[model samples]
Target: MKPSGTASAHSDTFARDHLPPAGQWPELVFDLPELLYPDRLNCGYELLDRTAERFGDDRPAFRSPDGGVWSYGELRDRVDRIAHVLTDDLGVVPGNRVLLRGPTTPWLAACWLAVMKAGAVAVTVLAQQRPTELATICLLARVGHALCDIRSVEDLLKAQVPGLRVTAFGGGAPDDLTQLAAARPGPYRAVDTAADDVALIAFTSGTTGRPKGCMHVHRDVLAIADTFAHHVLRPGPDDVFTGSPPLGFTFGLGGLVIFPLRAGASSLLLEQAGPKQLLPALAAHRVSVLFTAPTAYRLMLDELDGHDLSALRRCVSAGENLPAATWQSWHERTGLRIINGIGATELLHIFISAADEAIRPGTTGTPVPGWQARVVDSDGEELPDGEPGLLAVRGPVGCRYLADERQSQYVRHGWNITGDTYVREPDGYFRYVARADDMIISSGYNIAGPEVEEALLRHPDVVEAAVVGRADELRGQIVAAYVVLREGAEQSADSLCAHVKSELAPHKCPRAIEFLPSLPRTATGKLQRFLLRTSPDPHGRVALE
Candidate 1:
């Protein structure tokens, strides 16, 4: 057997070549032998093939909003056909990075499994991204092939990077995976991949630069399901899952796809799921499980008077802090205690969470059964309970940023330092403090100010732009941007905000945009972010230069 440090000379070897050095990686722990996976593991085989084998094909696997559903047997057959299409038609082999762009749909889910099953890395990009954003991802991941929904063809075409071969699916385009899969005959054999083989490269917006790629392996996929979903969530086969988060977002990926499928259950896919649509869909599909951010829950609170969500057995909230008031308000409206937890794209899914019986309001519950978490000081020493410090976690899964130096900063002495400040209580619960960096956490979404600035700069009118988090009473923080327009530019705040929204995700849009003739800068012309942030509040500006 090859050691962990050696690379395999396989067709899909981009991820292996970009992994962090073995010594710099966060120390991985598999203290629990029962949950330990074999050295060679294929998550696609374990999550889908094994589930179908044991459940006897009776349970529903996935259902779409348009009244379409597939049983385990049907899903298995379809997945194999798609896997054959990826290999035989697209020439995809083990370890290749495949970019997927589209809304959350059954076909998208199938493509994800198909790519993994064929021993390739799945890179899911949001359909809302503009061509420029899409292009950046293509370059960063060195994506060999792409699969996009027909609706996204225009953007996909515009984001063309050399060497990226894109195939369109859904809406029956000539190059669709659906058509290809239909023509293929398959009960294709799954690829034999090691447990540490990279299966996904989830991107998180960068605070100081372009978006960063977080690599996760085959075992990391099962570890999330085995530890958190198994011990905390405990969803049964009869459970039906539904949510609003995009499949590109790890929070949504775990909530909507991995968790349910791991439990031998099903998920309801929706294109758009604001409160108005989510409530009725819940009643229509008899959704038993719900996953969304605190923002959505807050919006749905006022409309709860008439919604029939009695069928919902569990509601999981993440992507932001679950305030006690929000928790109390939710419990007051519906008799369900919201399952709140914290997870990052880097870690793949939730590692700290508490379910109904064990949940404590206002606190993110203790570490999951298979993980260890603690508060640490600047020197990386553990802090006593009740002292706010950096949150460091070590478990079956840890951060593996693709070839980024930030990996060193994130992982210190074998522990993953999630850049959040927290205080562990004497009773073993963890209380949220604030983000350890300059990141803006708004409406349960992480918004990097520099990324917003980069998006703002994409507009022709903007010459200089600086973004920062403004304190907010409800959403925690809002993106507040200061911009300097180019000569003869007359862009309104709303129009400029819209331009940013078009370039980036909706959550990253600037809520308060102020037009300034000039911005504070260092002697070397670097942005003086501290001055913009040192104001008395979101409304106050620092002493002008």
Candidate 2:
């Protein structure tokens, strides 16, 4: 990696000091004109203050659950006040890792922008994280200051992190962030930070063991808006956005916050947005653009008749693979094509996606305008168009793990080697096969877990299905399926096995079928395959049927 052209604006260099060695950095490619960012850039100012200046200040930026709306000017004013609190009151300097813990709300969003405006590295964690998880993250980031929601501060306090300063928000108390910000209503200048300075460190979800912090810079933050949102999504200022992902997840941060703000659009912040609440919220708020996972889409399909979805024009699915079955069903029911994309926290947001007429069902569309991707074999050699191999991507924004040894594993030969197995079609569309570790090999037959899961989803009685390779003595390994059936539906394991055999090859059928009320998922709605793989089976190993 080349040395940064501009000097950093950070007084506290902990974030920069902990960055992985220069040799471990991925090759960042800026092949597009929009990606040429200036040296001094502040993403928070660009998204809020500059947006209010370019667009009208009176335009709505965020909507709350209690019928309150914050306009662009209002949001900028709030962010500036909070910036003053972070710098003047909290003594937080640039590059200091400040942990942000809260539910999805306007206050939480303001706190995030405040950290960015003050040039501090934000370490945002999920509110559902336990004390141990919190402690682990704090230690890894060397967090010194924290801004938390008033109600969710208990767990953070229980963490008992050494020398951690916690400031609570969303309450009337004297020390609350809301009260403190209100006390100082004047405008605060945003720091002139180098575009390459660390802006945030997003940790991987619990779906993987021992979360690795993904470091992203200010320029990287805006690149997502420029590449994916600008070229693919084509969101407009009039669109009202909403999603189920919390701000802690980069998917949610991009879809619900950055993308909308960059487009001069607005978003409705929801604290409780499962399918039941999401359906009603979408109709009531007239949400035009929806961002969520395929599981939520499947669950809401059953309740579509009761809600009016005339206002929704765009739908984005991420956080996990979107089954072609779910995409087709949604389009058949709503007449809106779901934009399927694959993104990683390390890269910050969606790098590959398709929208509207460009979308080919079952295939993740071509890489976004600023990005390039290809399929490569285990030896990192380029694979044929029709062959399945590891997915390698290079773009304006790339992976940068914070002080983690896994950096070498993720970035190789100047490309981000995402651990997903994929196929590059002759037409240039990418088809996901499975996670590299998720491929089940029984005897000599290779079977993709998602392919089997897709077949199981086609069954009328199957609400959800997860397939994993179980240890076997004779067959090497066998496919085991854990399924959640439709409510009140009962089908024998033999019947389900027959259904799979009819849909796919007989060898792909699960040898052991277990009924689960629900599959395990992380707070971000990602399937916790590791959990399902580790969960104890009540029955002992089954013989080959």
Candidate 3:
């Protein structure tokens, strides 16, 4: 296997050669040979097949927070048993959608694997999601049955969506469907599924509006593993993978489940992976590779003064842009570069990422292998290097929003138009500018809010910063900043605003600054800028000229 550095070099080379000229649409280069399967197969079965053949009885495949470890052989056995139970006992079969609700645990992993292995579509809902969100997702997915943690059954019951058979795992089940691993037959055969058959339905964060389910086939899992893990992480069998992302998010799905299994590595699944829980888990597991978002890294840095993080070799930052200060601080403390990537629910996982050796702090780096990226104008015309425009991508796995006509809007003319603004350097590195929706149009000048946020993050007193566009009577919309200062840092609004104006363009600086104890974020750690857009001091009135 190539070293991480070598893989990044190959990716840089491909990006250099394939990226379109300034103002031209990007042309992708497909180098992979044709395959027997036109679409991808569900990865749960593929994982079972690999483990059963190679290290079935050897290493532990999953380690749960409760100190339970399941060997590959045991995991496969349990998955088979559950598959049989789902098919024979519950009457679930191919084309049926099964709702899975639970925390990130070994049982959740087993349930996810079993559902797909049984040829049923798995719809995973975040355990923290309220009853209304859960009910909407269940109704939208047309879920016939649900496998959820016993602790969360009350929430499901409150949703009051009738006719849905509920199966309780982790705790004793008193419901219609229960854990049948002990009683079900172990010799279960997987149903033959087409490559295009839907294996899982992941819901997008409703940052813009209501959440929509993003449909993905079995092939997307392996495709993401091959593109991101093979080309970016390059994990070995001995590598211990762990992170803070919830299992419900595709980011966690790729990092904790699919990537580790694809590379024959072991993963540490913590029931609670907040900053308070992550440090001890990483130390206890001797985790070598870490995957999390940029915000988590910032928080971890604060808690790592005397922590022994010597075991970590690579740390991946995703879900949002990685600030240069966060990257620099992490490297200075741990001597490890944080590999930043840009992924979406629509893409299923990461498409643009940087490996350790080739990491360009503050930039999202080049595209992963088998994927193509470009910065394009409003009309889909390619933008010149150093020019910010909307980002578009094409790869083996693309967005197929479930039952939504907006799929056409996201996927236009064979290119998935990811609603992100970015600038590509002449050397092929792509820097994240901001979300397309978060762009501030002030007096006809286009400004990416994230650029200003990054500038604020460089200030020593700043712990966290969020930038958003605020409505302005004169400028149409102006930049606004919400900041969380470090402990003992003064919260003088004027000084902070002055600091930002000095570092960034006067027009790009926050027209107002709001002090906060903490900024709100999604479970995946993405900054919730929409909340800031509606704030009372939307335009930073305190510092207005």
Best by TM-score: 2
The digit string of per-residue lDDT tens for model 3 on 220-326 reads 67788878888888888888899988778999998999988877788898878887788888877888888887888888887886666778897988888888888
lDDT (tens digit, per residue) of candidate 1 on 122-174: 99988877889888888889887998898977898888788889888887766
Error at 479, model 2, angstroms? 0.1
Cα-based RMSD of the predictions, in order?
9.8, 1.2, 7.4
For this target, which candidate reaches the highest lDDT against the unseen true structure?
2
TM-score of 3: 0.92
User: For model 1, how many clashes?
Assistant: 2
Q: Least lDDT summed over 10 consecutive residues: which range in candidate 1?
A: 536-545
Clashes of each: 2, 0, 4
Q: Rank all candidate structures by their TM-score, best first, as comma-separated numbers.
A: 2, 3, 1
Could you tell me every candidate's TM-score relative to the true structure? 0.82, 0.98, 0.92
Residue-level lDDT of model 2, residues 1-545, one tens digit each, is 44386899998887788787888788888889999999999999899888888889999999987778999988988999999999889999999999999899998998899999999999999999999999999999999999999989999999999999999988789998888898985798999999999999999997878899999999999999999999988999999999999999999999989999999999999999899999999999999999999999999999998899999999999988899999999999999999999999989988888998899988988999999999998888999999999999999888888899999999998889999999999999999999988999998999999999999998988889999988779899789899999999985787788889898988999988888888888888888888777777625233336
Q: Arrange candidates by lDDT, highest first: which order?
A: 2, 1, 3
How accurate locally is residue 24 in candidate 1, as Cα lDDT from 0 to 100? 80
lDDT for position 73 in model 1: 82
Lowest summed lDDT window (length 10), candidate 3 = 1-10
Q: Predict model 3's lDDT versus the native.
A: 0.78
